[model samples]
Target: MRLLTVSALLLLLLGPGLALQIQCYQCEEMTHDCATPEFIVNCTVNVQDMCQKEVLVKDDGIHYRKSCASSGACLIASSGYQQFCTGKLNSVCITCCNTPLCNGPRQKKRPPASGAAAPNAPRVGLLPLPLLPLLLLSSTLC
Candidate 1:
């Protein structure tokens, strides 16, 4: 009974820190839409906490690379190449986002030309919804 009580207490304390792993659209291609549901993948838990999107404007056509990335690496890459993000010939733009499936597509409205950062999309809540009931039941049984 004491062990069960301790386990339940631990669950209540630590469970909120756990979250569903983020999912992102993952693909590399210029010929097809990589943002489609077919390309979605669950990012590596704990290691990859963000989605990265790279758009390259080439002579032939635009190319896209999408994949899971660590937050530090993604942020550095995106900011380092910010000046080259112009949508012109041979331009390269990289962006990082934390929200699920945020790298999927561009919104219809464009960001301002002044280069100010756009507000981040809302993140998934820290505690997953399904865990609440489990925590409650564990508390009662203990």
Candidate 2:
């Protein structure tokens, strides 16, 4: 219950969604050396389950399985019960930083002007005392 309360408070205060994950995709097909006739490859940064794991993937003749890596260590792959490596397959991870990827320029958002405030900024003593109490109660209950 405490954890849920804290998570709820964080979601409300932080606005929404997880922060941007600055992933520099370095995978097999992500490299110049790797080109497979059998499969396609893609990668994404997932920040769920209290984990920051990198998902390395390989597609066999039939399907793809992510050989999940947690931070730096390799964990047992999801495609258990199958020995699915091939001579054509290339393993990709952070170590393969030389792997070529098309990255665009980073965008920076400038803050609003310092002297000006939002149009919706609360005016001093705008609401009467009774209304103020009601607003507080509503926010807490909400």
In order of listing, the candidates' clash counts read 0, 0
Give one digit per residue, the lDDT tens place, for model 1 in 1-142: 7657766777777666775589999998654548888899999988899999999998888899999999999999999999999999989999999999999887799667776655694655665665676667677766
Across 23-87, the per-residue lDDT of candidate 2 in tens digits comes to 33222333132223332223334421111112234554222222223333322332331343332
Query: Whole-model lDDT, candidate 1?
Result: 0.85
Residue 119's lDDT within candidate 2 is 68
Q: Which residue pairs overlap in candidate 1's backbone?
A: none
Query: Against the correct fold, how does model 2 do in TM-score?
Result: 0.21
